[model samples]
Target: MNSSLTLRASAAALVLTAAMAPAVAAQPDDPAARSTIGVHARLLGEKIVPHKLSFQNTTVGGLSGVDRDPCSGEYVMISDDRSYLQPARFYTARIKVDAGGVHSVDFTGTHPFLQPDGSVYPPASAGDGKAVDPEELRVDPRTCRYWWAQEGDRPKSASEPVIQPSIQFADRSGAYRGQLRLPPQYEITMADRGIRRNKAVEAITFGAGSRVLTSAVEGPLIQDGPEPTVEHGALIRVTQQSRNGAVLGQFAYPLEKIFAESDPSSPWPPDTGVASILAFPGDPSRYLVLERTWVAGAGFKIRIYDATTRGATDVRRMDSLAGQRVVPMHKKLVADFADLGLSTVDNTEGMTWGPTLRNGERTLLLVSDDNFAEDEVTQIVALGIR
Candidate 1:
């Protein structure tokens, strides 16, 4: 979550991605999560920005995706605003953190993303499925340009046009560069096929050694089956592709079950899905996968897993995986916010690597999408890792 989004109705946050760490001595004040294998991570600090903080005429919230800009040393955060409050855009931010704690998180600037026509995307009210819902975004370290994923609108009625999801490339200045070709599975036609709206491409990350950029749908395809239930999890495809959108490999990721029951009288239903994924900076086959589940009265349960494709099946050619024999990626729990004792973890999505500690341990940083809600918060948390 290149970057992340969230799924809270009040915030309407559908968080999309976190990751890196080095080993070192622990601090007495740090809260450590489960660490049986892979590596261990400890909380370093957390800082909350005012909800709906205003900046440059834009509401400074709904940050669904984030990445460290190797070119500017600033963190690039994408807001899933859908052009409601402003044009589709991303903001450059500076977050200073060390072993002791996070010193500060500052917004330096914001850039409006340009559509292919050299125009800003229209708002959802403009309809005809022309609005953009920008989710996870990343910097192509090689080109210093930006790559982003958006969960385009699925038609709510026959009067509404289908806005197919997209993965696109933009320059540092927010100009359109190009677009990656999406797989056919992304094409919607029937009622029970293709991607589910708001559930398409929520996670993306480039592999460690190869130019294989990987992307994942937030939930399952209509044909794949239903969403996660309390009794059983589900499956979503994570695609490995080239920058030009050439399909390289695709594997099924096993989504965990929703943690609790929803409120029968509540208007909103429960949900569980992939919030983000970060590839191991050094290992092409490994990643830190974050899964977030929301139960009506139970709130959000976020879990980071050490996932690998070492023995998973490539389902790029399969039409449906409902009952087929397939090996999904193997996963192990790395950390859980529920276990770390944070005051709250609402719609926490985007995450990236921060500065390495003096002890040689690398740090991981996370930011949340407050959905511009006054009760929610724009939060940034840091963790020390090895």
Candidate 2:
């Protein structure tokens, strides 16, 4: 199941306050160089639309992941439809970005993801016996092939079977090629161990020159520790693998306390997790991680953090993070979407580096999943980064 559909709303009063509050700028002084990265975001535009944005028979709303194709200067977006609405698929789009903001977005085409058997996924009612819940999408810089992550569904009962999560490779046309093997820790089972349901792999990116593929889990594994709470944070493992799927290394990433803007004391903890990641150009050890939290009544708390694995402990050989001393990656606040001065923010889950502007500064683009809700919207937000 897609996790964004489960987000609840927060109190109206608290939502208003959070929306209007001033954003605190991030400033981390560099000890050695005596200079800060000075990262900030200027809102280009927030394009919001109805849930039924369609292309022929398919609806283009459940956008879980997005990436830019430098070769074509177009963007590719993956929908987490689970073959229920249509065969599992992705779409190519052309978005016009200018000084004013995003002027328009046009869908060029949609391609169905083919299975190894050379058949598209059947509808959910068909009982096709295939487990696919596409969560993240990326373009393999080395081959221009499309790579996607699927958070395979967990067994609902003892009688049901478990489907392990996977990262799959496909051509631009979405033909099945091969898949990357995940470590045993990511396997799902009937026992109360391993990854929690709907909380497996959620984010993936190519590091620097595309030599390494990094993936992030949505939450900590059962043995890692408990889920994050208001008072305590949790650690999730970030794994790096070679383009051909050889495991290289793994490090710990600390997740901040759950963001419940409406009611921090609310009994139910809102869904908070890593939504997207973008590797720094020519730097495999550094990345920009996007964390999004949605409270029931209030709204979204979206933040970007600059993360580095330098000097971090490699937990690949470690059995568990609990009762063990480990050094997690260093993270610094980059920008808060709330501070970007947008009128409204939806479930922003997908992000990637856009084309550089005339001034040579980089741009970031984020897309939101409406979950096919009438009250919600599918939004594409552009930001100027420096």
Candidate 3:
């Protein structure tokens, strides 16, 4: 796709990956089992702290894609080379961490994980690629493969472009394996935006087995408005169809109506919620959704929802994270590596849960993209999940 569309699509899709935790409800007297507004509260107001796990500066200058292996407790971060508007290289790193909040990340090697073929068995960023702005990363334990989703568009006309988010995979040992173009990638067709400029897919992750979950950042329509431009987001599940193939399911979420602005003076941007969503590990019926908001006092808001409830159950205040609150802990901008050193990159995107650390505490990590900005530095930060 063209530069404007490329920038808009990527920006809209990846903007809400980092979170500003909100205030949590007061804890009940009985610490074991307390209920708040029909939701159970446990470990509320616990003095939890976030320590840096590992930070690495890739040669590509901007990190966009991230995937964590459950079995090995290792993470793979990709530094996307979007400056030349070409296929981005994948920078793989093996992360080691302890519950005491000590983290170490080793840069394994850099490699291209896509081939020109329509199949996914070979890894090569050969010909037939526009700008490979890789966005989504998923690791499958059942099959022992790593999947990367490329965010870009292909077109039938100059005026109209068709953007189909594509995905490919690799093995745990860091082997360039196969690539798979999303099923009926054309199913997300936008007839008006030409054959190419119709849709933009961003965040992606894997579920149980061949099941994959992904999101389309916006709807087919684009409207001009204030600085905080609004767009649509969708959630879809894809299952394997062949030996190494997949098919899209009918179950897709159109988030336009999910969190619409209720008051005209609310000042909340339209189509606010719905950018990145992750399924609850043990429960297939629950999901954690990251809602994008750039308004005053609000940067990134993450909420937990019961898949059955179909509504936001709780919200986290990641910006003002103090251990005082019982429900949603808050955090502020302590340090952003990009702004601290690298000047060219800024937009923070890409988040995933790593294995548990000290005292069986799980870890949550977020990655930011420099967008190939000349003065910005790309970084990855890890936090202790409560």
Candidate 4:
């Protein structure tokens, strides 16, 4: 199911809460997990401030892969449809956060984007080794062009894998201009171990100025589940070339660096680096990596990491995301429609940084991936990064 699809009005809130439940619970706890920095909170110390922003979920189309425009302050989200699987299209919306900290998101329209042949680039029922799924999206800080990564299964030995990474450019009106194919350098690999594992890529962002960064959802292979633990998500840097549009260097986040303080035998794995990565504007060297973990049964934990120092801190973790929680302007509820409706999926796949709320206050935005289940409803949440 496409997460962007619409539902009946009465069922909308139910679906949204249920879909968000697992993702909200994925933020598991770690007794050893420590934090030196402090930030204010809501929901009896369960919620943060920036989430007060509101979004108008559209009924006309399915949307995913949301990103914030650095220059315009507008939010741009894309709906991935490879022919029948998903049509290659983009959505443009303007988000307004009030002085009192009230928030709202409006979906303006859908921009139809296609491949070279004018047909959808990634066709549904795509075979192995084919370019079909578009997983992660990012905006270039310098040129403002949009970049998306293809996440599909690794081609079998008998099937050939077309390892091509590409970027898309658009005009101010959100019109498609051109695309440049990125040359593949490094394939996804395990942290302590070295081998290409899970082929799914969850999120992408800009890092260290003009550089690009991304995280794989799971290893090239799945553990017992379809995804990896927060500890298994790996971060890597991508270098682009001025000529021939080549991807130069690929550096995976060293697992030892992330788990340096954790007990070696402890079952609580380090962050799998799922969710999304955000490189702060103005300061590129500093970035925030989000990891959502489901440690025991249903509770969740969300952590923020300082990429420059390779340090991390827990932000908010709760037993239920849909239950009433105090934000800023009002009391709010987080509901995961999926848990109550269909497949049990909790995924926060989108993240971006926007203009500051106050004079010196920084803003961070996050959206959950509903995976388009009948009971799931997608949500766009915001935060003020201090």
The candidate scoring highest on TM-score is: 1
Residue-level lDDT tens digits of model 2 in 1-386? 11111111221211101221111112122242122223667788767755687796798888989999877889999998888888999999998886578888889999989999989976545544485888899998878889999898776766555667899999999999999888777788535578887889999999858889999998888777777655556778898988777778898887777655447477765788888888888878888888877777777888888777765678898767776656666676777777788867778889999878887668898898777777667888998888
User: Per-residue alpha-carbon lDDT of model 3 for 1-386, expressed as tens digits?
Assistant: 00011001121222221122112232223221211112211111111111222323334545655777666566676555542433355666676544543255566665554444423221123324444556666777576577766655655455544335666666644455766655443333444321123134455555544354543342322211111233323222212233355443322232322322235556654333233445546543334333332233323222322222122122111111222222211111212222222222234456677666556555656566655655334555555544
lDDT (Cα) of model 2: 0.77
Candidate 3 local distance difference test against the native: 0.40
Candidate 3 regions exceeding 4 Å error are 1-58, 82-87, 96-102, 117-131, 154-163, 171-199, 209-275, 293-346, 374-376
At residue 273, candidate 1 shows an lDDT of 82
Residue-level lDDT of model 1, residues 296-382, one tens digit each, is 777777788777766567889988876555666666666788777677888888877777788999888887888877766778888
RMSD of each: 9.4, 8.1, 13.1, 14.7
TM-score of each: 0.89, 0.87, 0.55, 0.57
Q: In model 1, which regions exceed 4 Å deviation?
A: 1-37
| CA-RMSD of model 3 | 13.1
Clashes in predicted model 2: 6
Candidate 4 lDDT by residue in tens digits, 87-204: 5556667777533442566666555455545544555455533454555567667877676655544444434554333455555444556765443322333232221333345556
The lowest-lDDT stretch of 10 consecutive residues in candidate 4 is 326-335
lDDT by candidate, in order shown: 0.77, 0.77, 0.40, 0.42
